[model samples]
Structure formats: C-alpha cells, structure tokens
Target: MSICILYYKMFMFYSLCLYFLSLYLLNLDFTLYLELNILTLNSISIEMIVYFDWMSLMFMSFVFFISSLIMNYSEEYMMDDKKLKRFIYLMVMFVFSMMLVIMSPNLISILLGWDGLGLVSYILVIYYQNVKSYNAGMLTALSNRVGDAAILMSIAWMFDMGSWSFLNYIDYFLMNKEMIWVASFIILASFTKSAQIPFSSWLPAAMAAPTPVSSLVHSSTLVTAGVYLLFRFSDLFSENFMSFILYISLLTMFMAGLGANFEFDLKKIIALSTLSQLGMMLVIFSLGDKMLAFFHLLIHALFKALLFMCAGFIIHNIMNCQDIRFMGSLISYLPVTCSCFNISNLALCGLPFLSGFYSKDLIAEILSMQFMNFIIYALFFISVGLTVAYSMRLSYYVLLGDFNMMSLNFLKEEKNQMLKSMMILVFLVIFKGSVLIWLMFPTPYFIVMPFYMKIMTLLMIFAGILLGYEFSQIKFYYQNKSLKFYHYSMFFSNMWNMPILSTLGVSPYFLTLGQLYLTKMDYGWMEYYGSKNLFFLVKFSSQLFQSFSHNHLKIFMGIFFFFFFFLILSFF
Candidate 1:
C-alpha cells in the first residue's frame, strides 16, 4: 500500500530469495552462468555475462538486506529533508551499481559498475551543498579515479585475451608473467578503492556525506568493493604481490586504529574504524585466505552498519553535535540507542561470540599459523590492540562521562523505524557470528598453536582497554599533553599526514608544474613563435592581399599613363 511497505517487502523478498539461492548453490557446489549476446563483430561477440556462484549470491543477499535496513532507517533519519525523493533515487542507484559489481564477472561490466559507484558516491558526498562537502566530494572522487584508471588499463590489457570475462581466465592471469601487469593494475585498483595507506585519507573526509550514506557506503558496500574485486581476482595474485599487499594492509590497519584514538569527530572516528577494519580484511585476503576475508567482510558489515545507525540516532537526538567531547551520559538520554551502540562497539573489538570475533579471531589465529617476520606479527597485534583502545576510548567519552551538552537538549531516541532497524542488527551482532561460522564452515579449520600464542589476542584486548581508560582519565588543567606533543599527535591523528600528502602536499607541486608549463610554453615560447607569430603573419599577409586587390584597377590605369609618359619622353 505505502511506498515504505512496498520498498521493505521488495528488498526483504529479494534478500530472502537470494539467501536461499546461495545456500542451495553452496550445498550443491553448483554455479550458474548466463550470457546475453548483445552483438557480434569481427568474430568478437559482445555479450553481457552474469556469474551466479554461491559467493556472489551470498554477497548480494547481504547487500540487499543492508540496503533495505538503511533505506528504512533513512525514511526516519532523512525525513526532514526537502529532497527525500532525490536521496532515495541516489540510494537505489547506488545499490543497483553495487549489484552490478557483485553479479558481473566481465571486466567491462565491472568497470561500468565501478564508475557508477565512483560517480554516485561523489554526488552523495557533496549532497549537503557546502564548501566542506565540495572539498570532501572532490577528494573522494579523485582518489577513487586512480582505481578507475587502473581498472581501465586492466581492461585494455585483458583485450589481448579474446573476451573480457576475467572469471574464465583466473589461472591464465596467474600462470602468465606477461599478463602480470594486468594483475598489478587490479591490485592497484583495489588499494585505492579500499583506501589503503596513501589513498585512505578520503575515507574519513567522506564523512561529509549524510550518516545514512556513510553507513551504507563507508561501512559495508563502497569501501568493500575493492575487497570484493580482489576477492574475485585473488587467485591471480603472485606471491610477491600478495606479500606487498600484506604489509601495506597491515600498516593501513595500524594507522587507522591509531588515528581513531586521537580523532574527535564522531563520524570520522567511525570512518577511521571502518578504514581499520578494511585493512584487516585486506590483510587476511593477502595472507592467502580469500574466504576468511569475505567472512570478515560480511560479519563486519552487519555490526558496522548497526554501529553507524546507532551513531546517527545519537547524533540526531543530541541536536546534531558530533564532537564526542560534548557527548556524555548518552546512555541516560537514549538508552536503547546507546545500548545498541555499545553492543556494536564491542562486536568491533571482537568480544567473544560476537559477530567480529568469528572472523577476526580466526584471522589472528590463521596469521599466527603463517610464517611471518617479527615486524609483521608485532604490527598485527598492536593494531588489534589499537582497535580495542579506540573503541573503549569512544565508549568512555560518549556513554560513560558526565553530560556536557546544554541542559535543555531534548535527547530522546526515535521510537518506530530507526529503533526497528537497530534491533534487527543487534540480534545479528550478537548471534549472526555463530550462525555464519556454522553455515560457512561446516568443517572447521584445524588451527594448532601454543597456549601463550593463543591467548595473545585476549591479552592485547585487555591491555588496550586499560590503556584506553588511562588515556581518557588523564587530565591537566593547564595544557593538554597532546598539545605538548602536538607534532606527534597531529601526525598520528592526521593519518600520518596522508590527508596532506593526498591533498595539499601533492597538489601544490602539480599546480606549480602547470604554472611553469603555462609560462614557459603557453605564455613565452609558444606565444612568441606559435600563436602570436602566426597571428601577426596571417594579419600582414591578409592586409597585403587586400591592398593589392583594391589597387589592382588603379595600378593598371597608372601603368598606362606611365607608359604614355615614357613613350612621349623617348620621342622628344
């Protein structure tokens, strides 16, 4: 009857159907491929291909389920906005693009979806129509464009192969060293899309977007696209390339987790947490466990989406104040939302039996199983500690501290739609980890390790909690310690100056180069010899022709008179 009901029923139906389909496919070990031949020219058949394996189906199911919840949440969250229909349209378009990415195995089709994601995300990032939004949108678009360019190059390289279906040529990409460039391009594309290291600044910057968009795009779908693409192409990566990814992802994880501890903005803190988790996914993926990465991706999406939703509700209730410093005793004001937030936060910290623990603990144990250098091993555990520290720090500031906002602030949770969505995710956050592990890994992994090594993860978690509490408790009335060590705090908080490097640090050089080109070539030599000289030469030649033509008749008469004069003079 109503649009909301219709939307809910439609997405719910699709999600259920796809979930069932995925389970069936998984059970049967079957894959379904459908190709629609659009045209054929020069023996090259241009066709659109859809590959329906269990992985794609399961991922799509998650996407649909999340989209449905986010849209429902948006109905309440974005209800006050004038252009609600436009927001809905953009959201649907975003979801459709994600579906295209998940379903298609063809590089050309994947590019179509990838570009769609970039363009739509840019529009969404700038939706607020402000200077900050504009800057953030530009940063997001430009960063992702690097990945898009890589994908385009990969497509060109793949052209040497008859068809653009990368699925059919996974082993070919792996075995052939000549096609290694294509694999490199694909990895590059994933790094940018996933916001690894240098490209990571945009993830937090993109918090300029609406919270709903951030929840949908940053938490679950957009950031994960690169991971999904890499997941599909995991078989193609060489050992060296995987090692390189491993290090970069580990660094990204550490950087994001560390930065979140220092970040003040609530949404940016969450955004940083998303970045940290993404790094974890990539770390696992690069460590030669593709399914483990996907498992984490799915579980992370569920809790992270819930986390963002809880955050949005909190932000809404608190009169749009995002600084956690100004937010305290939120548990007293919005109990349900705060409770949900705590649950999701704990899930993020990989508290036992929660959604994150299923994937994160497994990833840690598996990593320990692998033979890695001491540095890599140490960084991984430290990053894990940082994750807990930030989560605890955020909780202390938001849920436990004294109320700092205005006394008259009417902070109360929305009753109907927003709570409904959060409740659903809370259930998933608590129980879905076990269900997914059981379903996905019918036969569990046999991981063997010493007792001390096994308990290292828990030790890090406890240490992180203590450190986080201590950091929050520290106070000096005269000056903040962070200000005393301003340089280091700024460096760590600013994602190791990646934001500067990506924006101001690199842009000025390019601007300077362009200026040099403009002066030396466009204004100086090219102006003198190319355009300016050519203009003057053309003008002079045109003037000479015009004068000659106009005087031609007069000259003929003058010549006759001169000849008569000359003949008379000769006769005399």
Candidate 2:
C-alpha cells in the first residue's frame, strides 16, 4: 500500500478510538507532569514543565480526532501536488504543536507549542508558491508575530512566579496590580490569533490557501487556539478586563457578520463566518462561562469543517472559481455536495435540534437572562440574525437561482475520497451536540426569560429567511446595482477596506522610513563616519609611512620630535 493510504487508515482508526476516549475522559480528572532541564539564567535552573488534566485530555482527544480526519481528507485533496509529502509533514507537525498547546498548563512550555503553531501555519499559508499566497502568508505571519511577541512580554512579567506554570501560581497573576498588564498582553495575543476586529483582514485573505488547509485552519486548530488559551486563563482576569473583552468580541462578531453579507467569494464568506463564531465563543468566555464557550467551540468546529469540505467539492467542480455570483442550481448538478453544504449551513443557522442549536441556543438564552445593557443584547441578537440572513442569502445565490456561469462548465466528477471523510464528519455535525451536552453538562440548564425574548432567535431566523429570499429574487437588482460606483457599497464589500488599511497603513510608512535609513544612516552618515573617513585616515597614514621609508624620513622625524618637544614644554 502507498504511504499516504497507510497513514490515512491509521488516523481513521485513531479518530474512531478518540470518540470513545473523549467520552471516557469525562468521568475522570487527573494531572500528569513531565519536567526537563531547559535553560539556566543567572545560575538558576529552569525546567520546562508540562501539565495535563481532564480539560486538556478532552480537548486533545478532539484535536487528534479532527486532525486525523483532516489528514485523511487531504490525502485525496492534495493528491495531484508534487509537494504532497512536504504538506503532510507540516500538517503532522502542526498537529503535534496543537497537542503541545493543549497539554501544557505552563506558559513556559506552551510557548514552544505556541511558536511552532505560528511558524508552521505561516509555511502552510504560503504552500502554493504564488504572489497571492505570498502576500496572504506574510499578512498571516506578521499579524500572528504580534501575538508571539505579546506572549514573550507576558512571560517576562511572569518572572515573579519563578516558574512557567501559570496554573501552579495563578494567584500571582490575580494578586499583583502589575500582573493586570500580563492579562492585558495575553488578551492582545488572543486578538491577533483569533482575528478579532482590527486583525480581521488576515482571516479572509487566508482563503488563498488550499481547501484542506482552510478546513484545518478555520475550524478546530489555528483560529480556535486563541479562544482556548483565553478560556484556560479566564479565571485570571478582573471584571473590568472581562468587560473589555466582552465589548471587543461583540464588535468582532458584528463586523464579521456585516462583512459576510457584502462578500461574494465563497471561501471568504465561510472565513468571515468562522470569525463571527470565534467572537461568539469569546462572548461566553468573557461572561465567565468557559465550559459553555468550549461546548460552542467543539460544535462550531464540527460543522464549520464540514462546511469547508463541502465548499471545496463545489470549487473543485467549478474549475476553482469561488465567486458565488457565477454559481446557481448546484443542488441539481451536485446533489451530494449540495446536501452536505445545506446541512452544515442549517446547523450553523441554529436550526433546531442540530449541533449548533444545542450550544448556540443555550448561549443566547443565557445572555438574555444576564444583566447586560440594551446595546450588548441588541448586538448579540443582531449578529445572530445576520448569521441566518447571510446563510440563506448564500444558499439562494448559489443553489436556487439560475446558473450564472458564462460558459459550458463540466461537473461530471464523483468526489469519492472527499465525500468519504465528510460522511464521518456529517454524522458528528448532526449528533455531536447532544453527545457533548450529555458528557459536559449532565444537568440541564433552566433559563428564565419572557416568552417573547425566549423565541427571539426563532423570530430573527424567519425574518432573515424573508429578507434573504426577497433580496435574491430581484435578478435585475444585482445586475444594475453598481457596487463600484456606490462608494459606501464598495467600502463594506471590500471587507471594510481593512486589507488596504493594514497593508498601506504599515507598508508605506516603513518603506519610507527604510528609504531614509538606507540613504542617511546606512549609505550617507555611516559611510562617512565608519568607512569613508577611516579610508582617508588610513590613506594619509600610508602616505606618511611611505614618505618616511623613502627620502622624507629625516623631515618626518624632525616635525614629529618638534611637536613632541612643544607638548612636553607646555606640560612642564
């Protein structure tokens, strides 16, 4: 058998086993430790400490479970590529790094996993070797570098604990006034990784990667890492800090929902949806409900990964075209892909009894009963409504309307390999919600709210259906609606112009600064003071030496001696 096939079978075995393992871990909680001599600073021994508990075990099991499927999926998805082996190697290393992050309770050891994630993900983003891939990879890598730097800054402040394990001495962070800065720094790091607000452009731009990479990145691992970290450290934050996170997360969700509505690219729309979901997880975390956030995180991963795979199949059929405007009636042509896509989309919309409904409905209910201001409540519901609107709008434009492609597109291919992995994920997307709820929260939650508020999600959901359908029915509207001529339309359609802001905002200023430094510091001032002036001095010394060695030795010595005698007389 080929190596990729062998590897696929092994991971499939592991993924099947991990489902049972995740269930078994719920009943037990324990910590296992491993220590290694790392480094010595100021003659003090520093040991890298690793920590694992039920939380870590449960999360690690899911990570492995999902990663196994992603690898298996990529086997066929990347079959034609020359660099398939290299991609697989990076994928495996990426999984290992995520495992490290999940298992380590110490900030010190987690840094290894953390940095590995940034570096490997950067490499993966640029895997295609195109200008678009290069730009996307740089945007991805630089944005994440900010978070890596923040982690280092937090580690420096953590020196007071004398150890890298924050779980061992969480009180040090909670007690010190200065340690609040550490928490602040950690929050900033999470923002960069999770693509919150100003860091939002990279998430959509990252659609330049292949489909399997998008599935792995947007769903279980890379983007979710920030929420997992912040959720792990949620206990260390003050209420004010919690409030700061709350507002920002809401804004991120709001921004992403708005962006998705205006977006036409299929992959980018899905990427924006992931961003919106990350914001939702952060909301629950900010509310001091880590378990609920985790529940949402797991559920979101299952459906979103499935959604990306389904989209991949469609893109594969459409000759790699991603613009939704060119797609319609795919339901008739690609039934299996359309079914998977619709199921995942419905789950995302929180259609009752699906995976997302269980976790997302609970979150909205819980938020309704909490002591929140009107704007927060409104933003939460508005974001939720936007999710449904965009989902329906995407479906209408891509599945229900007339075919919009300009040429005869052939789509006779049967996607056996991609569909095989998706079937496994489809089962999870359908049922993982109730399974996780049974394991994580054995006791049912009782929510107290007004009847109208209780059904608000249902109301918004139906409203979205109406608006999305109405908007899509007008064929001439889209044909005549000039997004370019309409300036505000262009602004939002272009992802709030964040790509321009981030690229132009940083690149031009630095390019100008670099120009000045190259001219004045490196070429001009440093040349004169460092090389040019030294060259002249050396040349004059060489001339004097040559004169002394030839006919001018006596004159040279007389002048030198006279100057020495004058200096001696002045001192006397």
- Candidate 2 stretches with Cα past 4 Å from truth are 16-19, 36-45, 413-415, 473-485, 532-572
TM-score of predicted structure 2: 0.90
TM-score of model number 1: 0.92
Cα lDDT tens digits for candidate 1, 26-85: 999999999998877775666799999999999999888888888888888898898988
Compute each candidate's TM-score over C-alphas.
Answer: 0.92, 0.90
Top-lDDT structure, candidate number: 1
Per-residue CA lDDT of model 2 for 177-250, tens digit only, reads 88888888889988999999789889998899889889988888889888889977887899998999999999
**What's the lDDT for candidate 2?**
0.84
Residue pairs with colliding backbones in model 2 are: none
